[model samples]
Each structure stands twice: as structure tokens, then as C-alpha cells.
Target: MEFTRPLPAYLVTRYHGWKATTYAENHAWYRRLADEGQRPRAMVISCCDSRVHVTSIFGADQGEFFIHRNIANLVPTYEPDGNHHGTSAALEYAVTALKVAHVIVLGHSNCGGVQGCLDMCQGRAPELEETSSFVGRWMDILKPGFEAVKDDPDMPRALEHEAVRVSLRNLMTFPFVKEAVEKGTLSLHGLWTDIGEGGLMHIDRRSGQFTVV
Candidate 1:
């Protein structure tokens, strides 16, 4: 259980580089942010995959976005069970406290979490079905999404897009989120990133199709 350790040399060197460059150049902005607190315009829920860089994609500066990264970027249905729920907690804080104007679910092509869900649903990954499996339970949130694309010839890709759709649907399940949307105080969006192509696709809710943005 011991946690004390030195950071790897590469990461430490990178941190020093950032400190000397971006941090130094934006020291005043960082101080202002610390003093005034964050008032991000949007809340982005994206995958934990290192390849998906939300800030880089949007060219957003520090404190411009309230970002939450999780496996598959999945948002579970609203469940007030008095248990720990990281994604739900972040959503609540962002919608109720931060008053962010927009909430975006950012999924990506070649998402490992989506692929895992596909594998589990197809009986290819029994390990994920075990009750003790953390990833299995977390990905269970996307079961309905996987079902929507299970029969497709391109299940992985389809499920990736569906993950965004599923998250948007789940966001509405939260009473606070729904109220904000109904009141026109908040908006929801679904987006999928093509990692290899360096392109972005926004879901057309009306058409249920991903159109290039």
C-alpha cells in the first residue's frame, strides 16, 4: 500500500519543459485562474486513451474546458444508490456547480474500451463478465450501446459512435442535466474523433448519422 515514489525521469523532464515554456508564458493566467476559480464554457467527457487529446483538438487553453476522462467515455444511467460514482459526480458538479453551457461526449475511433465491450457482448471476453472485473462492470454501462451495433458488420466502429450516443442519452437521465436542458441553460452534444485521419465527426441527432465537422 506504500505510495511514495519518484516520478519517472522522462515524465519529470517533460514536466520541467512544460514549466519552463507553457507554464511560464501563462503564469499570470494560471494565477488568475487559481484566484477566480474555473468558469469553463464546456464540459468534455472523453476516453482515458492517451491518443485522444481533447484540449489539443479544440486548441483550448488551460481552464477553458472542464474535462473528465474515463474508459470509453461512458456515462452510466442516473443511479442515486449512495455509492461512489465518478462520472455522475463530475456531471453533477459541472452542470449544477460549474454551470457549464455545454456538455460534450467525445468518443473516438479504435477505442479499446468500446472494443472490449464488443468482445464481451460477443462471448469473446469472458473475463470481462466476471463480477469482480472492474472494467467489466464499468463497461456494462454501454451494454445497450453495444446491443445497438452487435449485429453490424463493423461492430467496433459502430459501437464507438454509439458510445457517444449512449452517453448523451444517459446524461439526460440526470434530473439536473434534464432540467438545465429544458431550461435552455445547458446543451448536449455527441462527437467522435478519427484518430488516424485527424478528423472530427459530429453526430446529427435528427439523422443519427455522424457528419464531418
Candidate 2:
């Protein structure tokens, strides 16, 4: 493999700007973080969508949240089959190593991954049905979510919310996460954001409804 491509000029310029301004102003904080290591109180699992800025949504500073991003923000069930599990790896580290008190799954409207899952479930996305498609396989984790919302008039929005629910349920499958929750050391949260309106909805676990926040 060849590595010839360099960082984009715009990104390089942005990095220099941040390093000079934000980094300079917070020099001591950055150094302390580097020396003491991160001890974020919460772990946010969010979508890979660029518009869904987790830190910005909460107005959090650097080193405040341990975030993991993936398509549809899906979390597969605990499978210790020894295969590569990026999401699972992050969950393990956050729960066991970092001992984060809160685990938040943040979903958003107009999510491409959710749309892809919708299409695949409806038999419209034949490509995603192929085993060779990594994204297709990953989105398969949300098939049940699709089923739960397939009959709804607002399928897209419903599925997006269901995705958060699915991930929350799957998070409990991990033994460590379950233990922490049972011991009252950890909590799980599900949130859905409306991208265009910038409104947020919080899931009520007992009622299984997403109410405005």
C-alpha cells in the first residue's frame, strides 16, 4: 500500500488555527489532560454523520466525553467470537477501563444509515443485501428496528428512534455493562435529535416513547 496523500490544505489551515488560538488559551488544561489521562464521566455513542456534533450539542469541552461514532450508531449484541468488533471494543474500554458512569446513544433525524437500513429491509437496496457489503451487514443489526416501525406513516423518523432503542438493549447484553448497571454504578440514555430544527427528544424507557427535551 502507498501513502502519498497529504492532509487537505483547508484542514491543515484549520488545525493551525485551533492550535494557535484554542490550544494556546487552554495550554495548561491540555497539558493536565495529557499528564493525568482522560476520566470522562460519560461515553457518547453517536452516528458517523458530520452534522451530528455530540460535543457541540452539549457544549462540552475537550476531554469531557469519550465518543464513538459509527454508521446508524448501532451496537451489536455481545459476541465474543474473536472477530473485529470496533463498537464492542469501545464499549468495553469505556465501561471497564474508563469506568464511565453514563453511556448515551445519540440518534438523529435524516440519518443516511437509517435510510439505508430502511431501504434494505424493504428489498429496495439489493446491494446492501449482499454479504460482501460491510455496511449492509452492519445495518442488518437494525432490521428488527425497521420491522417495529415499518407500518408507521413516519417510518424514517420512527426507525431512527428505534435504532437508539435497539442499541440500548444491545448494550445490556455486555456482561460488564450489565453488572455496572445492576450495581448502580452506570446508567444508559437514548436521545434523538432533529437535525433541521435542532430539537432533541429523550427516550422514556418505561413508556418506550421519545418525548421532547
TM-score of each: 0.97, 0.98
In model 1, where is the ten-residue run with the lowest total lDDT?
A: 146-155
> Candidate 2 residues 26-78, lDDT tens each?
99999999999999999999999999999999999988999999999999999
Model 2 lDDT, full chain set? 0.96
Record all residue pairs in model 1 with backbone atoms less than 3 Å apart, i.e. clashing: none
Q: Over 4 Å off in model 2, which ranges?
A: none
Compared with the true structure, all predictions reach lDDT values of 0.94, 0.96
Stretches of candidate 1 exceeding 4 Å from the true structure: 1-3
